[model samples]
Target: MEFMDHLHSHSGLLRLVPRRPFPVTIAPMQWYRLEFHMANELGTLLPSTFNLSDIHVECSLLDKSPAALSSHWHIDWQLLLQQGAWDSEPSLQIQFLIRPINTSLPPHLPAHLMVMVSPTYDGDNSFYMLPLITAPFCLTSKRQTANNLVPNNRAWSNYVTQHMYRGFSLPCFDQRYFLIRESWVHGTPGKLWDSALVISDALARQLLPLNLTRPLKVLDLSAGTGVIGLLLAFIGQHQNNTMLDITLTDVPEALSLIHDNRCLNKITYPRLSVAPLRWGIDKDIQAIQAKGPFDVIIASDVLYEPIKFQDLVKTLDKLTTPSTQTWIGYKRRGLKLEEEQSFFTLCHPRFQILDRSLDENVIHCFGWLGPHAPTLTTSLPPCLPHRVTGVQIFHLSKNSPQS
Candidate 1:
């Protein structure tokens, strides 16, 4: 497939001009430039009519208590206009003056900047928000600068390769960088799938309240590069109150990448570990069982395959204690809604699944503007002006046996 075709296939409406060096990194107190050019799936300019005055830049870290990171920095809109950053058409360009990482702002590590274009300035005009136009950059202290390495087989090498995700950062609770290896199946760490973000968002909002008085043992089952588990462990370490022992498990093929990612984060928590686990295999389950029951279980975007759904639930049943809570975040794969429905139907008998899709409380923590406006919900801000159609998070606990 051609380069542009590949990108259009993966990301329908979002296109990055000069899409290279993804997971854009920045040193503390340095200056960085951001470009905002948006187009729909057909490669046509979207929202073509907009004055510079109609553009607004909003910045925030994806955090439990997110605060604006763009307030005190300098922006040069005129320089951007002169250069014509967007194909000599109209594009928004803003130079960001990086600042010291503010601990007060709930530690949204990989900070994101949103370029919103309000179509009309007339009284009470409705506007469209483009979530694709984002600056997914991270700020590192001088000493930790070496952590950001450019991969040789770069995922976002060109417009074509960009469709195949190489690495991505989870912004909140410190930036967790993940390197992606191609998977034969759907779930991989490289793509910031909605399910992963949902799990991260849930943890950030309720980390303290959920584990306030007791230390909790956590598991990220079928973890792809350990994104969900690693985020929990790092966030717990940052909090210093809720003690968390995290175990990241997946098939043997995924173990090496998981180990590499754990190292990439420089985890010093002393309790995080990774091992191989295949669902429905006795030996694999035994390895997990050796660690005993976990307090909480997290799985993201792992239920798409219909054949493995039973084994997955069985594994969860074995690993979780009576009081343990399992959180599953799922995004619909293609048009197959029945597959999701079937997974839930089988799960209903053993688990009391609470539908927490698009929880307002979680949204509020991550800077949710009124529903229709372009709001930052987790890492990928919903730019569509509508809720993400099929993405949701469910809270699962053991259901009592019926007499």
Candidate 2:
């Protein structure tokens, strides 16, 4: 029975990795090719036990297009069992080609590719859709080879991403825009984190009434592109009474972009700076403390990986003071419940968790006007909530007196 399970393992799940890194851009009216290798882990152990029935590959542009173009924009390939047993080998190599088309596709759009395989044996039927690739790319005027470009090199370039927030900062301003440079092209700062928006919104509302007259010191841990920190700075500027001195910290690879984003925003009212800090490192902790204890710490989407959970908790322990307020926004990705519980368990010893339930205070704080209102004139457009889900915001503070 165990041997049969081994043979069928390749049928239910496909082990696929991108042959090349993300952001694979290509030109319009030119042929584009993509290559990938499929893992055949069990083929050697039980080659005769199962048979490969079919293989299917698909590529499509996810962005909205004209009805005529959108309907035919996708490319697909299907292969049958008569094509021979391609799965008998230890690994299978596949390539896809996109033929030239007349449509004028815009630049900076993302193309998604998915592959599924079906295998049958001993009168059993099953299919596997193991690997899905989302490569955010654009159609350009000039042709280029997709595989030649390295994903990591683009991370240091001037790739900019923009985010808009409603009813942020001053009540008079209906909306605000933030331009961020993504240091990691594979979608660290490259992607806009929804949790960042929710946490920033909640923080602004909760702190508005406090009205601290003095300059408020703030820190953003794992601050990808410094979105939350930048929002807090904007809030401080609008509050008139509180000045927010902001420090944005992340891995060394991300600091270059964080500094560039701070400059792009033209922020001057509240001093903004960047630091490179690896979580749980003693020297890094001491360097951050040189700026003194922060009044508020903001983090978002930093707890996705389980291995880093302990280090993150230690970093938080080092940064929090008696009066420090910490706000965290997390989106639960399936399969990490243990990591989430473990994080809170470690945090329970030193910090008290504030209730995360969304009430009228949190909702009204959005100040979203009706959909009929002008884009920039409304605090927030009504449609924002529809796009937000599966996210929770937590507020925490030290339970004991500061040493």
Candidate 3:
């Protein structure tokens, strides 16, 4: 917990780090000071584990191109103990330094940094650290393919993907919801968030009570990797209770990914199905509606583009039934509070906001059917803001006579 406290104090470091000039060199002995603190109390007891808190580096710019600047840098850091006893040797516990051929290349700005400690039989746990970042730099020359711009370096791409996947493993739920995934197919973090597995977890947990007699019919809109639907299927299969019928729909490009994921998960349930469902497409909407009133509808991080938002809302209005509960979770990106408020206002007349929570820049909204559902505003309150995000629950009853 002490480490967690220290990290909380330095949460600003989690933001994207600006790209500096490249090709500048640094001495072996001199490196920017880096500090790390274990944020998980349990991590401290784990053998050969360390948590990253802050990273600092110094670099100089070498060449400026239309797309990016190139620079070299040096990094130094102190290792904080999260788990197991440190070796008696001073070197084992002392601050260490590493000087990788740091290149701050243009167009590739750092977004977020990740550090992981992997234990080995002979040597101590090795630290695999990577910074997740991107910059918008256009190429001056025309390119035929994405690979033409970047070299064929799978290592860097894999490293970035692994970093993102780890973020997905972090705890982002309460008792009401928990993410479930049988396995990651593409295993890319950036794509995972787009999958909205977290939202599906929350919806499944909320609807569990309603599925006492028969299997729950769940619909996942904009399904990317099909993580949400797969997780629900896994839960249903394991519990051996009610059957979980899942229908996943997305654009063609995303549908292919969903199909591969479904196959990768070895899903054989008669109720599990995947199909293409694009917003604003009449055929897609009708096909989705044919599935009938699903008990739960889950969508996550799908409200970025303005056009897509309107299309999505319109599609929801047509597909949702009085008995269906729709849940939407979005990470705050370019969308402003006013825009979000406007969105809610437009939907408020049709769907009720039953529950809401904002944590780690992510907003979760639970909506139910009916016109007279209760409108509740729950805040985090300053005291518990650090621990739990704002949690609000809303309810709409289709059976209500007033509706």
lDDT: which candidate is best?
Answer: 1
Q: Considering lDDT, which of the candidate structures 2 and 3 is the better prediction for this target? A: 2
lDDT of each: 0.53, 0.52, 0.42
lDDT of 2 by residue, 23-117 (tens): 34554445434334343222123234334434444333323111012332444333322321344343333333333343565434333222222
Residue 321 in model 3: shift from native, Å?
1.5
- The TM-score ranking, best first, is 1, 2, 3
The residue ranges of model 1 lying beyond 4 angstroms of the native Cα positions read 1-18, 21-187, 209-211, 362-364, 367-386, 400-403
Candidate 3's residue-wise lDDT over 1-403, tens digit each? 6554443331211211122211111123332222222221112221223333222322211121111122232234554332224443111111333333444443322211122221111122222121221211111212322243334754344222221111111112111111212223433311555224335435545545434567667887776667777666645544455467788887866666666555543555567778888887889899888986788787655666765667777788887777887767654434567886666665666777654453422223221101111123443211112122122223322332356
Query: For residue 35, what is the lDDT in candidate 2?
Result: 37
